[model samples]
Structure formats: structure tokens, C-alpha cells
Target: MNEPGDIEVERELVRAMNDSAGNEPVPAYDPQQLAASGRRHRRQVWALAASVAAVAALGAGLAALLSGGGPSHTVPVTAGPAAPRPVGSPPASAPDAARGWATMRTVLLAAERYENPATRGTVQLGQVAALFTDQAAFTRVWGSGGLGATCGAVADGALTMDHSGVLLYRGSVQLPDHAAFTFDDRTGRISGVSCGSGQLPGGLGHQTIAAVFGSQVSGGKAGDGLVGPQVSSLDCSPADRPLTNWYGDIATGGGLAVPPTWQWQVTLNGDQADGPLSAVVDHTGLMTQATCPTSSP
Candidate 1:
């Protein structure tokens, strides 16, 4: 509605508005500040990613440990019977040692009865001789009538190793259980044998002897000294002493995998001619095997 005169006033008003805006303050742009802000933002992003990666790795390890997956760092074990060894092996270490020694005692008793020159036809049985490293070793150990004393060890009590390879009876000097032998550290074989107790299976005991020879023998161990037919009992005729008696044939009426049967085998005689007198006895003092006639006129 302004005429040509009003047009000039409108132009002046616009110019005044621009002049007032120019007087107000405005921030100056600094390239360095912008650059630093951009750098900080990128650093924050990287830090977040690194934290996530560490957490993932930690979680994986925990999972593996809990589940027993991935490579394990633990040892594995299996259970079963020990490998079969010939009679009179050195035996196990402590804990199971007492039992092993007891078994050893029984084995040695059988050795003296069966291997003694008077009792056995051969110089010695292969099983008894196998305890030593070699034939020479066996001769060395058995020469000079040393078999009786060596076999007599572990007679009265539990046998234990003194860490120096010496056997201790109930672990006391006053109560010494003579050492039967020592083992080689490098070879795990018998190094030597010595004796002081001078013991022998002596005799099986009155009850055991009674089972073999009724009132014929006065004492139990009297027959231990006799040889050949002299020691023959009610069952055997020309029977010699047992060659070897231990738990004997684990497969016999008991399970092989069972615990030692605790029952020891007591042979009336092992003549090889009589085949162990057609009978055997055990710790219970019972006649486990009785293949004999009741009596004769």
C-alpha cells in the first residue's frame, strides 16, 4: 500500500535490522579444538570395544573350567588288580606293606620247606629261586645255610622299611624284625639279603601239624626238621614239603580280583609225587582240601 515514497522507508528498515545483527557476538572457529574432540570420540569407541573382548575371553575360560571341556591339566587314574608276579616279589611300600610282608612271610616259609636240600629233590624250586636276580644271586643269598634265618624274618610282627632300605619290626630296634632284603634304587631289584633272627617257619602251629600228623608227632614244628617220608602225614605216603604255598591259584574257589582272600594256603606236603597231598589247608585252620583215606588197619 506504500506509494513510491513508502518504498524508500521499507529499504531503510531492512538495512537497520542487518546493522543490529552484525553488532552481536559470534564464536571463532578453532581447527585444533575440533580435531581434539574428534580424537577423544574415536578413543572412547576403541576403549569400549577392547573391554568387550576381554570380557568374552574371560567368560570362555570360565566355561571351559566348569564344564571340563577343552584341554585338561589334570592327571587321570584307573583301578584294577596289580600285574601278577612270581611268588616272593619284594612287595609294596607302606600302607599296603604290612599285608605284602605277611604274604612274603608265607612265601619264604614255603621256600625253606620246599627248597631245603633235604626236603626238595632239586637244589631249589624255580619259583623260590626266581626271587633273586639270578642263579648266582640265589646261590649267594642261600649259601652257608643262610636260607633259614632269611626266611624267618617277618615272623612275629608287621615289617616296615626304614627309608634306608632296612626293615624294621614294628619299627623298633628293641623289637627288630630282621630285614629280608633291600632293593636297588636304579633297577628296583633285590640288592642283597641278610639275617639275624635266625628264624624258620619253625612249624605251622600245633593245630596245623595235627591236621597232617595226628598224635604221631609230639610238637608242631618237629616235622619241620624231618625230610622225605619221615614228614609224611596221615594223607601223604612219601610226600616231601611244599614247594611253594601262598594264596595259591586265586582262580581256585575264590575270585581272582577279590582282596587277597586273607586265607593263606597251608600245604600238608608238596612231594611233586603226591601233588600237594591231595589236599590243602587255610588260615581258618580248616581242612579246605581232604583227599585222603580216613584210616588204615
Candidate 2:
């Protein structure tokens, strides 16, 4: 019940934790919290990709007022079935590994026709490029200033070294819908990118994402310990190995987080679909989820 733009992402994360108190290191962050956390995480990744479009437009305006409230009236509701098809596999090749998975499914259908939030652009990258290998290691793996900055395609290919022989060239990027990019296909680099839950931002209208994390999502709480809980389900298959980020070049700037950070980890499945189910992302893209039996059964 937050989504008013997540009350401005909890008052801009409480004014970026009161301007990064004491430590005095994490300061210099004011590009409007880097453009309101990348437009409220792309409107929480299109509200997790049309989660029933605002309750199907309030159930089609209550079935057109129950067909004009006539014909012996009847409006019972129960729905909650259809939600299967979520296994995993595919997208894990390495003969040379510089971009496989059929060019990451045509760069996730051309970055889903360029940020198609249902349609027409802005950002959404839905399938997150099914987890990359091509498209220049998915713009260095999910290009990020923090959120939006993707580019795609660049690895010329032709370098073989796996078995930790290490040459690395895979690809992935699709934050359009909030998160994805799995790099390395031959120096086009970026080893992993996952981001979870179709795209999470249910803090809804969170007062315009808490006026752009002006305080770091209100000094810890919503999933505490770095953000966990809330999210329900999410998956991005393919991962035999390679998804590192030792500080892939470091330089987050306004998008927060310094000292070269950009990590990965995903497996959400939030809405309690069984299993301990837990997902976590950090290094500053900030993602969370947890039921914690120890995280995923």
C-alpha cells in the first residue's frame, strides 16, 4: 500500500541517509537522486509488468457495473490461479562465449522495442535479454549509471578461454523493466546481472520514491539488512558460471554507491510460491526479497 511513487522512495531514502552522515565519504549525490532512482526504478519496472493492469482496470470497472446491475445481479470474486510456467534452463554456452543465446534473443527483442513499458519507450527490458552473451556483453552487463544507461552490442567475438582459462564474453542487459545483464563474450565483459521480480517497486507512489531517496529509503526498514522481503517471485535462468563484478571499473557517481560496485544474485519467487525463496542484489542497484529459511529451499 505504498505506491504513490513509493512516497518518493521513502523520502529519497531519508535524504540519502541525511546526506550520508558522519563517514562523510558517500556524499556528492544530487542529480535528483540520479533522476529519481532512474524514474522510480522505471515505475517499479512497469509495476512488475502489468500485474493485472491496475486490477484489470478495477476489473473492467466492475464488469461494467455488473452489466448495468441487471439480470438477477451476481458479482462474486475468487481468481488467483494461472501462474505456472516458471522453470528454467537455456542461455549458457561457452564454446568461446562472447555472446550466445542467439545474441541474447536479439538483445531481448531489441531491448523490447526500446523501453516498451507495455508499449512506447522509456524503459522496461522485460526478458532482460534472457540473460546475455552477445550485444557487447550486454552493454558491459546491464549498463548502469545506477539504472538507465544501457547501450548494447559491441563484442566482435573470437576469443576462447573458458575452464577458467578466462577470456569471458557473454552478454545481457534489460533494465528497461528493472534489471538484467550477464556479460562476458570476449572483452565486451560484465560477467553477471540478474535483478529480480519482473521488476520491483511496489512502494507505489512512495511519495515520488521518497522525493528520490533523499534519505536512503528511510534509514533501513523495508526488508531491512539491505532490503529483503516484499518481492515474491522472479527468475532469469542460465548460469553455469561467470557473473562477477570486482568493481567493474567503478564510478557510480550520482546514481549512488562508490568504490566500484555492481553485483548480482537473483531467485526471488516472492508471493510465497513455496520454498524459502529469497533474492538479493546490491552494490547499489538495490534489490531485495526474503522468506528466509536460510534463503531458498
Q: Which candidate number would show the highest lDDT if scored against the true structure?
A: 1
Q: Model 1, 228-277: lDDT tens per residue?
A: 33223443333443222111111123234232122222233322322333
TM-score against native, each model: 0.34, 0.16
Best by TM-score: 1
Worst 10 residues of 1 by lDDT: 242-251
lDDT (Cα atoms) of all candidates against the true structure: 0.42, 0.35
Query: Runs in model 1 with CA error above 4 Å?
Result: 1-43, 56-110, 113-118, 124-181, 185-188, 193-244, 247-297
Residue pairs in candidate 1 whose N, alpha carbon or C atoms collide under 3 angstroms: 169-177
Cα RMSD (angstroms) for every candidate in the order listed: 12.3, 39.1
Q: Give the TM-score of candidate 1.
A: 0.34
Residue 165 displacement (Å), model 2: 35
